[model samples]
Target: MKNFLNKVLQQHSLIYKLILYVLTVVLIVFLFPKGGKFKYDYFKGKPWLYENYYAPFNFAIQKSQETIDAEILEIEKNSTLYFKFDEALVQDVRSNFDERIRQENYTSEIVEEILPIGQKIISSIYDFGFIDSQSESKLTSETLEITLRKGNLAFNIPPDKFITSTELLQFISSSLANSAPVELRSSMLNILSEVIRANIHFDEEFTEKAKEERIKNLSYTTGFVAESELVILKGDIVEGKKLEALNSIRRELESQVWSESNYNWVVFGYSVLVALALLMLLLFLRKYRNDIYENSTKTTLIFLNIALMVFLVTVVVKIDVKYVYAVPLCILPIILKAFFDARLGLFAHVLTVLLLGFIVPNSFEFIFLQIIAGIVTILTVSELYRRVNLFISIGQITMIYMIAYIAFTIIQEGNIEELNWFYFRLFAFNGVLAFLVPFLIFLYEKVFGLVSDVSLLELSNTNSTLLRMLAEKAPGTFQHSMQVANLAEAAANEIGANAMLVRTGALYHDIGKMNNPMYFTENQSTNVNPHSDLSNVDSAGIIINHVIEGIELAKKNRLPDRIIDFIRTHHGTSLVYYFYMQEKNENPEQVAIEKFRYPGPNPFSKETAILMMCDAAEAASKSLKEPTAQAIDNLIEKIISKQMEDGQFMNADITFKDIVVVKKVLKKKVKNIYHVRIDYPE
Candidate 1:
């Protein structure tokens, strides 16, 4: 049991990486829509690239959305408007007119004459139904006819057939003008006007119901394809009928309701594809970028960026697939390049684009356009600390996206006239969103404890508090650091290493000298040899203590681990030869070498190794009697060779070829410092 526990503990990092990988895969797969994928890929006006297709099952050929919308508009424009004819209300009006005459208690002859006249008016008003005044206002002169419903039966009535309140008043005035005296007409008008009521009303509910019924019965399918029928031949241009049939099939397949067993299989298929893509990314980091692979934090940052991009794209696709291009997928590579290298950044971007291809429509065009944009991001994005560079890079990425999309449209549509300007706006919006990368980099640095070039640029400023203190307390050491920084920067540029990082590291490598300025040789101004008054062992202890003191000072000032690495590794484990030899000569048999050594894990990266080379070369050059071309070259060669012999660079990821280049660069730089002219080789 103890042995099993030991093994588990020993392999804990590997187990953690496995867990992270599995979780990422599960999350990505869950984000994906659960649906069947149509196997065949086709585009309108583009050649069918697959084998000859036959109808797999009977499916109706669906019309385009434009066609369906046009048909609905036509139905709304010309469909019959309905109104209800109230026969019971007409009889009540007649009854009320007679009752009013009886209540007046008129003379019998007067009553008889007025009552018959009032009844005649009421019957005539209702004969051509009194349409409601509110309903009459909504109609235009163009409404020549309306349908009148009497219970189950419907009558097609002309506008002239129905009477409005205005028309009813006119009818009563005209009728009495011919039939009655002035006083009698006035009395009858008052009685009939009160009795007359509109019996026809616009049946808004029934009219809407009739319209909806017509719309619901509208045919969405223009034709049907039977099973085993030939749909399209290979290499045929998919257009018109062929395009519509293929689209109908695709819709039918995607919308199919899967059984429980089929649903599981569909999810399983998505899981396998997603896992393979992520696995490739893992293997790539393991084989070519082991440094990043070993660091779980860095690996997590890369995976996290990829997952966030996928999530953004998936959400946009769900909301509206047309806006998919506006997601700014190229931000992935740009951000990765800022924190890491271009190669890893591009690789991760491509893998992410591939995963997204499954979710977006037109997989080929989407993948192609995004991969190209990602490539442009890697090539153009640099100096992330400079805002102008990021803007310029994003501009180039947007232009590439627009050009690629235009080309795709021209090919598919066979004309520029049909090009979608909507996507160009999306690409522009994509460029606008890419401005958020710097903020994201800043956020990631704080959350993940990672440093980017932007932060490094801030640290590189000499006016920073720690750097200023070094100059004030140990001016000589500060000048030495400056010289070393120049030398390291040149060497790094020559060997294709991180020049900014190496230069920044070189400036802070000797900050320990600030604590005891007079102890170091560079800080001493007079011939007072404070070290000569002490024993060689005590002198060596003070010299070695500087390296230890530099580390504490670096941490106290909150320097990044990357910069502090230079302080720890600049002296490596090499012994302080001058102090060690002096003690050895004084006490022939009692000399211990470890007392004179600097505590170190040695240089473990190209930048740290470059700092080591430049630091030793710059300091030793100050001891020369006469600085000449040959003397400088020999001095550089000897110092580097001795350091190499001590295994100082064994752990560093640097090649001997890079070392040779660094040596040549240092030789030329040192010679230039003293104004020494080079002699032409024989």
Candidate 2:
């Protein structure tokens, strides 16, 4: 059950799982129905339903009609009527007067002869008519008398009466004023007053004169005017129903817009999940931050840069696959190379390839290609050997990338022609990036400290600042270091260990000798040893002090921790056999082996174990008179066997088989250094 749970957890990302939980909560909250009903009545209709359905079109029409009726009533109260006639009326009057006179000779009497009489008679009749109806028949010999009736009949006049069209128009306007609404009546009254003031009138005389001639030729006619009453049009019931329906639809749409639904919950849940996943990723990166780079600031910056590059590539992938095909797996190796160790670069490559498998569609082929390219690039540049050219490493990486691409193409059954182009492009890109890495590293080193991976190579260089300092300060120690390095490197390679680390650690193993160089055997140029005058105990103390002193010197010099460990454990509680033998000969019973032994806690680590074995072997090999393969082999085996029997290799993880291999490799290396002599006739 425990394994099953762990396996299940491992199958999905922890980050993704955390996100999923948050998403689940969001989904539940959003999907939970607050009320039982799916629709709400409040928002069921169109927004403009009230405006369209209840607008008073009937009221507008009724108001307009009321305004028209009021105007007509006002006109009826104030309006008046008038009548007038012209020359045609005079001809009709003359004919009627001739018939009334019953004399044929009266027809020929010229109207010009009676014109002044007629004018006087008409003026007297108008004066009497305004005073009283009984006094209106005041006519001279040639003029006809006319009666004017008030209220009912407008005017009773002889046919010979003459009037202008303007006067007739004024009389008709007055009549209209009395019959229209007050407002209309007032306006008509004003028009009639103005016409009367201008001497314009319309009466029965004008009507009779107009009737005697052709209708088209009439000079004046009675004007009739009426205001049409306004009526309100009824509202459209169908329109009102349609508005309600629209409102219902709108309300339904609105409810849909704002309502909580499963789909909304799903979206909300997904969003929360995505956010949580991002947060988890950040936390995970933070926990392993130190593994990313030597320096925190540079590591963070490099990580951010890589993340940004990946994000950009992911966006591009979402847009189209043609541009950034690999989904940013290549960025991991580049970042590792720039900021961390080559081993880390390889790890990052694998991790990025796996991540790409999840992010990019159809990513397996690209992932395979990335892994191949990443391993080759990292391994090729892992070492900083001066003899290995930078361009050559880049060329190797490029070749690997091309080969991987070709292999992928072949596996996919791609055409050779297409694969060739793809291969060329892949090589070009990989080669450029790989070639540029060294220069970038060089620049980084100049600005920052040495990267841990290359620090071993730098320490191994003879011309290194620290090594040169060691050489100049303590030549005896430097020479001892050279011998020890040869042995340690050979032994390490045989035992499948880091030879560079072992060799570099050996080089600085005896740095403490610089404090008191003359007291050491290697630096004692004259045979008068500094320890000759001292007691055995005092001599042993001085020798023992070197180990402690070496640690302090290493610390002061800021040597790597591995070198310090090597210095601390190289002696591994082994007795100073030569000095012990000397003291034992003088006082066999009294002399203690512990008194001559180097202070140690035994070789507790592989590096220190190798260093201890190498230091002992190198020191013992110097006693051989004529070095030979058999003699070197015998020397190596004896040294290892003694150390083993003495329990010097107790704390070291080295097995007996490993020790044998170490001895053989040491023998080969030592024999080569001091090969058998060929006698010459010197």
Top candidate on lDDT is 1
**Model 1 lDDT at residue 134:** 88
**Model 1 steric clash pairs:** none
RMSD of each: 7.4, 31.3
For candidate 2, write residues 500-612 as lDDT tens digits: 78888898888777778887777877888888788777777777888899999878777766668788888878887767787888888999777888878788656678888
For 472-562, candidate 1 gives per-residue lDDT tens digits of: 9999999999999999999999987888888899999999889889988888899888898899989989888888899999999888888
Which model scores highest in TM-score? 1
Candidate 1 Cα RMSD (Å): 7.4
What TM-score against the true fold does each predicted structure earn? Answer: 0.77, 0.50
Name the lDDT value of residue 657 in candidate 2: 81
